[model samples]
Target: MSNYIVEMLNIRKEFPGIVANNNVNLQLKKGEIHALLGENGAGKSTLMNVLFGLYQPEKGEIRVKGEVVKISDPNIANRLGIGMVHQHFMLVDTFTVAQNIILGSEPKKKGVFVDLKQAEKEIVELSERYGLRVDPKAKIRDISVGMQQRAEILKTLYRGAEVIILDEPTAVLTPQEIKELIGIMKSLINEGISIILITHKLKEIMEVCDRCTVIRKGEGIGTVNVSETNVDELASLMVGRDIVFTTEKTPAKPKDTILSIKNLEVKDSRQAVMVKGLNLNIQAGEIVGVAGIDGNGQSELIEAITGLRKVESGEILLHNKSITHLSTRKVTEAGVAHIPQDRHKFGLVLEYPIGENMVLQTYYQKPFSNFKVLSFKNIYQYASRLIEDYDVRTPSTRTKARALSGGNQQKAIIAREVDRSPDLLIAAQPTRGLDVGAIENIHKRLIKERDKGRAILLVSFELDEIINVSDRIAVMFDGQIVAEVKPEETNEQELGLLMAGSSKEKAGEL
Candidate 1:
């Protein structure tokens, strides 16, 4: 009596103090692209996890192809032709793409050991069919993020999965890469693969999905055809408000060069230069946005500036003072605040209390310490104030940094770094895992810093965010900056071309 491939009727899920989903219902049509849209903590992710067999619903009945079945574990779900791509990737860094693709279900030779050649052949065939252009022989660590994502998709297809759930698949991709993903999704749909896309981005949902289901406050709102809904309507439905896509930022009145790198060349741990001849200038009261495809020397450039990596040959000046060889602490003292790209690794001590994470950079300052004695009181007070101002939602400051949701974790880091009021603020992927509200707040704060006469160097993979918040933009290719353009004068096409390693004139100068 069902017309869909998968259905969940009256689903209910609960966690200690939270009713994540309440009497929710979702249905996926065969060979169609479906989207689940919601704000943060809206039960979208919870619903997908339940469908993926990560959680068991306390109440509800699930039917697959009109037959009711129980999926107690991921293996059972996989057997039922279901595969999930998590928001954060699960690929091992040291493993090769082919090795990772065949990790769980490796082909056998003579019913013993592994037959990598057979596996590679099938993997390549699957990638070709799905248009997932990935080099199976390449290591996951050395490949581009877009290619890694393709490998993940290929892994799902290689496992003979028919129902695919993609969680924010394009969150870390560039403009060209996003287009490729969309094309792949369409091809998969044409091949009779049913897709369930979970994302908070309205634009992507509108562009790629046929139908969309909106959830709010752990309750199902409604489902609609994508063609019938507008972004404004989707925004209002998601957050129950009329959201503004653009912020009102004043024009930049750039002053003295607060941060400058001249003839910079940075090397990684292996002593090979990754950033070559990177001469850039960020002036006071301006946000110089760096837009590039991932693996275009952005990481090394940020590391060099933040004291995380050594510069082989460069002159870095903070307000005309050389701070290149200074320690991270010394650089912080010299008026440099950095919101690192990897938040958990460099931004916070996940096992430590939230109060401790608030002063991660300045814990050794005078007010936070007395000689060898630490001032827990001052630290706690400062942490509480930041939590209040930054809107970081948590039960208390004593809670572990890991306990906070992704958005709140980002908020904590932004609060800590921006509250320092440094002369130069380096925010690298500051809103990487955040929701719309958090992104809006972070963007406003970045504009606020620029308006307050603080030079901000923002490096992000999100083109929309970069184009919206920045007054000027720089494109990085390989290990150097290839082009610089004003916001009002550039389109995504030009930027995408630049990111793909083409110069302005070569790409038909705009």
Candidate 2:
């Protein structure tokens, strides 16, 4: 009998112009958490999709428990005890948690109507068994992102999945939630369920995974035992270079305030007050990073500043000129650039080509257009320059934005927003799903922009990023700016406590 629970040998998958996976091999031992580590476009998701039966591999042999099997579709994969939780969740916002969990594989009553109460009971039992605390009665739209992810996992378990694949699972979770997820994964393994984790976070792999398989540029680099390997070696194998953990920068010479907000109040789509009575300022040649747990008014504040969300009552001044209640276009014209938190929702048009998305901000002016007629020649030329300058790995500028990897999409947005050289740049979760190398490059670029006298407002859940990239850090708690501190003087533990509503004095005491 084979010790491996699953084996994919010499997998090859291809798109129209790109060979996504080439001779990639993966072997999963029974009940072990195997990590798939790679760069942004290094074909991690493509390989997982093949395993989940979302894509057909041109050449490969998959063996489950020493017997070869052909998984032609998701239903087949599920029947064969496989399930996948995608990076972007596939849950219905209008459905309740129990309804979403038992969506497809629902329980029946007397061979008639759907038995929702039984489903809820089973879901509650499963959640408790796996240490996943999710409310079955809550609506999907009302719950937090972490809770939504738990529902996704419960969906898999509800279908009797013995093998689970999680793609970038912690990319949107907070630190505490990530720790909880690790515990859940451990509990699942204890129950004899094997897991395949697809992520770019080396630290996560080191902490939870038993072994790792590294892929670079669509080919398998090698596999190593996590117990014997370190982060440096794994990073070098994935990125083909020695990655730098810290950013190089000089002390900021902050000039006059370029953007100021006073008594800002904003509401969410549900008309609930999210940002209340907030005050802050970003000076020229400085990066003011807002550090907070997710949903603590960070999203609303960014939306209010960039004109995406209406401010209920407050004043926003750019260059000492009031810009309150301005339209998005007016905000852009008034020298404000934004790298939005949700890239697909606000940053890029998925159906458009990468070249066109590059010129989204300035296409109406200058070389890109004349007399309201677009110049494809200048537009593509500009796109090509930024693509090369920012290391956006794409088959061509004509590729659809949806075809590119998440990190590349983010890079394209950063290139577009940063190239405008606006007076104030708002970067929200800029490096959410990126590798260490890409994060380093973006950090360097942001610093370069700061050096060029552009003020930046950064908001991130990664406490290390707030400390490493920002000159000044603001902690938000309960829709208000609770405290402002220099990054050099505080540590992540203190920041974490403050973000959780601990007073500065209490943080110091801890």
Candidate 3:
């Protein structure tokens, strides 16, 4: 009998005009956390999809406990104790945590109606056992993203999953939440539950995983124990080259102010004020990064500046002209470009072709359109250039935006926004799910724009990015700019203290 709990050997999967996975192999042992590392669009997710029965391999065999079996659907995979948590969560906003957990396979009352009370009791027990700390009665929409992720795990546990697949689990979590999740993974493994963690974050793999398997462009490179390898070796193996972690740039020469926000106040969808009397200024040829914990009114402030939300009381000036109440189109016309935090919601139209999405902002203008007549040739030609320049891996420009991987979709959005040469470019979580190589490229581009005398406002949750890329760091707390410091003078520890509302003197003293 094989010692492995799950094994996928020589798997091959293909889509139209692309080979997503070819001859990929993976083996997971019981009571271990195995990491699958790869670059964006490198077929890591495709291989896992095959294992979860979301897609069948054209050629390969799967073995569970040395028994060969064919998994025809997700239900069949679930029956075999396999459960997958996707990158984008699949929970309904209106459903409660307990309801979502026991959705398909629910406890019944007299074998008829759902026994939701019993389901909640079982879910509570399961969450406690794994140290997940989830509230079963909370609505999905009302909980934090970390809590929602815990609900997803509870759902898998409710289905009796012995093997869990976590796809980009830490991509959307905060630093504190990430630490908590690592603890939960350790506890799960202690109970003999195997895990396959798919991620590109090298630091996370080094910290949490026992072993790692590398894949490049749809082929398995090799697998190595975590203790035997360093981050440099793993990065080189994943991208076929040595990766540079820091971006190099010269000192900034600040010029006149390009954007000025005075006494800004904004509210969220729930009619609660998020941005409270905030004030900021950005000068040309300078990159000012906003560093804060999540839910510190970063999203609301960005929306107000980009004209996606109403500014209840404040003034937003671009080039010394007021634009507080202007429409989003007018704001864009006034030389302001935005790379939104939620790419799917604001950056791209998923149903459109990549070529069309590329020209969404400029399609009505000349070269792309003439007298309301569309020009497909020019649009596609433009998209092809950006695709090549940004290294977006797609079969063709005509491919649907949804067909591309999450990182590719993000690259497409960045390409469009940066190519515009706007006076003020606002980038929110620009490198959220990108690999190290892609991050290096983006940081270089931002610096290039700053050197070109453009004012850039960068909002990110990553303290490393803020310190490395920004000339000036603005620490936000409770919807206001509490402190400003030069990047070279500050470190992550001090920033973390300030982000948690610590006084500047206290931060410096500590």
lDDT of each: 0.87, 0.94, 0.94
Q: How far is candidate 3 from the true structure (C-alpha RMSD, Å)?
A: 0.9
Tell me the tens digit of each residue's lDDT in model 3 across 235-299. Answer: 99999998888899999999999999999999999999999999999999999999999988999
Better of 1 and 2 by lDDT: 2
Instruction: After superposing candidate 3 on the true structure, give the runs of residues whose Cα lies further than 4 Å from its correct spot.
Output: none
Each candidate structure's TM-score, on Cα atoms with residue i matched to residue i, is 0.91, 0.97, 0.99
Candidate 1 local accuracy as lDDT?
Answer: 0.87
Per-residue lDDT of model 1, residues 1-510, tens digit only: 678989988999987677889999999999999998876657777788898899999999989999998888888888889998877778999999999999999999999989998888888888888878778889999988788888888888888898999987877776678888999999999999999998877888889999998888789998989999888888788777777789779889999999889999998777777899998999999999999987778999988888888878978999899989888888888999999887877988999999999998888877999995889999999999999998786668988998666657888999999999999999998887666766787899999989999999999988788899999999999899988989888878788898898878876565
* Residue pairs whose backbone atoms clash in candidate 2: none
- Give candidates' CA RMSD values in order: 2.7, 1.4, 0.9
Ranking by TM-score: 3, 2, 1
Count of residue pairs whose backbone atoms collide, per candidate: 0, 0, 0
